[model samples]
Target: MAKAFASQGDLEEKKTSFTEIGRGLWAFTAEGDPNSGVIIGDDSVMVIEAQATPRLARKVIDEIRKVTDKPITHLVLTHYHAVRVLGASAYGAGQVIMSDKARAMVAERGKEDWESEFARFPRLFQGHESIPGLTWPTTTFSDRMTVYLGKRKVELMHLGRAHTAGDIVAWVPDEGVMFTGDIVEYRSACYCGDGHFADWGRTLDRIAAFAPQSIAPGRGDALVGPDMVAAAIESTRDFVDSTYRPVERVVARGGSLREAWEAVRAACDPKFADYAIYEHCLPFNVARAYDEAQGIDTPRIWTAQRDREMWDALQG
Candidate 1:
């Protein structure tokens, strides 16, 4: 197990908790771990995101078994991050779904992301050998797709670029519940290596317009009720704003990366001190935020080597 960015050490087994959102909707959350949502339709099941590995995903599958015997027919990749997509094969899903842009990212940088994430958090990659390589979506959409889980309607929309160029969300309209990928983490730190800070804010606004009664964020516990949902969105927005804006100002003043990092630390450390993965994410966040602030529209690719070099130079 690798150490968590905050004072807490690496997590072993995630404490799984199943929360019923709607009639057939369930959220599988583990203390601050990546979340996976379940939708049991008329005859089959749809899993929102795959975890880090098959071994880990099996735990989620086990939980699903306790509820229903429906075979998983669809596995949705909210984005192309390795941690969220690698365990996809375990589901044996008849169809793997994602945005077209997400598939493109997998083609471009999937291997690098896999290596980088493995190096960053080995604990999450339990039974790494069981992985059948990178996951690719079998079906993809450009903008939106509507899937019917029996009578329930599940709307998948590419709600603009936020966490990644291919980020999307799954909204259950009749239930007024949304599963926001990494775009809106509840209490967990936002990983911004491939994020677009400004666009993310806009994406949040779009999500807000929906007025979701329940929200299953990328990490942390599921937010129940309207007030908690609103707070979660605001918290995520504040995290992005506080982390990026000051770093941008420093970079614009010709400050060194080290100086800019220090500036961000001083500003964010106090407010987001207890947030999960803050230290692990800050360096990458600052780099991306700085680049975006400098008018870089697209995020640069992140490799394992680059990750370490940047960490040592700026964070060490």
Candidate 2:
């Protein structure tokens, strides 16, 4: 392949910012890179997504230190993806929480995913060696779990499947503030390499039902007002639709993978060419869409070797 994995050329560091979307809810966004959120309550704090490495995670800690002295009592993983969950050891929180399905994913594919992702996006995992190992949750719940940072009520729920089978969204009901992991990226390309297309659209509906006032998506700037929130969700839906529909149409006509890939570029590039990671996500996204549209229910595991093989076949 001419280009590096996904983001190899994306070497310039983004300027990270900590913005307060609600009274005590914060979003740590870095241009269109992966984001992390913070929820502060009367006595303690909860971090929504851990960075790719402990060293990268500490930057979030530094920002946390600037605003509150409260100990980070809880760590939450929105999914089992390495970039989102591998830095759990950095917080030293009392407990780490995730959906039970996410825990199972870790048990089954954690090592492979770790290797696959590290090679795909080297920029995100700057402090690669600082990672202790695959992040293991100290606590796991099924559908919903309600925890309080003193009086503040934060609800964690698995709202169906979008980004991954085990994706979860953190909701602060009191403020209508939401932390949607990779499920609702704004402007940035959604990495649907392991996603459920139709089910993902349904899951987004579940989020829209909440009518959140402010949202901190997995990437891009945090959406603040209700109007902004609505637009973000719509755009996400559009991205999903545009990518899948073309590929599905090609599949329906019994087209080849390369044919579907060409149709995808003609359809998506016009709309998403400027989106972050567009080049990197295109091959994987097309492959998965082709499979799902052809009746493959589960996304195939992406091992490091498989990554190279697929990239070579498509981009070579």
Candidate 3:
């Protein structure tokens, strides 16, 4: 193959930032790596999006300790991607929550995703051996579910799909803050290998309708104000559109996957070339976009071997 995934060579440690987006609500962002959110309530705390492994999760737990010693009683996952869910055991949260559709994906393709991601990016899976196994939710909800950490109410809702079929966001009504898991990224690139391109914009629109004062995105820095929140949502929308539109056009003309890839790069590179994981996500994003444009409703499961074959095809 002419190229391996950009993630394969990403060994540099990202600077992790723990910022307060709202009172008692914090965002743990590692540059452009996966981000997690914290909500400290009257008695306990709730964490959103565990890191890739127990060792990485310890970093978030350490940050939480600095702010409050309250037990993390709930761990709410926004989706079922391996990088977001595998570190779950480290939280020790009695309640692990995910959308019912996400839980089903876990049973169906979770193991394959874990293997594929591990093969693609070893840096995120810092302590792969320590991961207990595929992380399963102790509790699952269909559309929306509310969990209260004492008096604090955190609403987890499936506001349509963008990054994945079961993608959801956590909203804090009092703070007017939302933790959008991969649905809205800041300056970082959206990993759309398992995304729903046609529905992404509508999902983003639903997030904007709430007019969140702040947002803890799936990646990139925490958005602290309404302006930043709005900007991120639109930029993410643009990224999704820019990626899919070119591929859609190519597919309509009966172009090959390689041609679609070239089309996507021509459209997206000038805008997103420098974004985090941009190169790593490009091929997979292009492939999925091609499939979606060709009428594939569900994303095919990605295994380690499939990742290699897909990469090789794109290279040729």
TM-score of 3: 0.98
lDDT of 1 by residue, 1-316 (tens): 4334322247466688988877778889988888999988888899999999998899889989999998899899999998899999899998899999999999999999998888887788869999989999999999999987677678999989989999999998888999998999977899998999988899999999999999889998888899999999999999999888898888789887777788888888998978877788888998888888888998999998998877777766
Provide the TM-score for each candidate, comma-separated.
Answer: 0.96, 0.98, 0.98
Q: Give me candidate 1's TM-score against the actual structure.
A: 0.96
126-198: candidate 2 lDDT, tens digit per residue = 8888898899999999999999999999999999988899999999998999999999988899898989898
For all candidates in order, the CA lDDT equals 0.89, 0.92, 0.93
Candidate numbers sorted by lDDT from highest down: 3, 2, 1
Query: Worst ten-residue run, lDDT, model 3?
Result: 1-10
**Could you list the CA RMSD of all candidates, in the order they appear?**
2.2, 1.0, 1.0
User: Model 3: number of clashes?
Assistant: 0
Minimal lDDT window, size 10, model 2: 1-10
Shift in Å, residue 100, candidate 1: 0.6
Q: Estimate candidate 3's alpha-carbon lDDT, on a 0 to 1 scale.
A: 0.93
lDDT of 2: 0.92
**How many residue pairs of model 1 clash at the backbone?**
0
Model 3: residues >4 Å from true position, as ranges? none
lDDT of 3 by residue, 268-298 (tens): 9999999988988988899999999999999
After aligning candidate 3 to the native by TM-score, how far in Å is the CA of 292 from where it should be?
A: 0.6
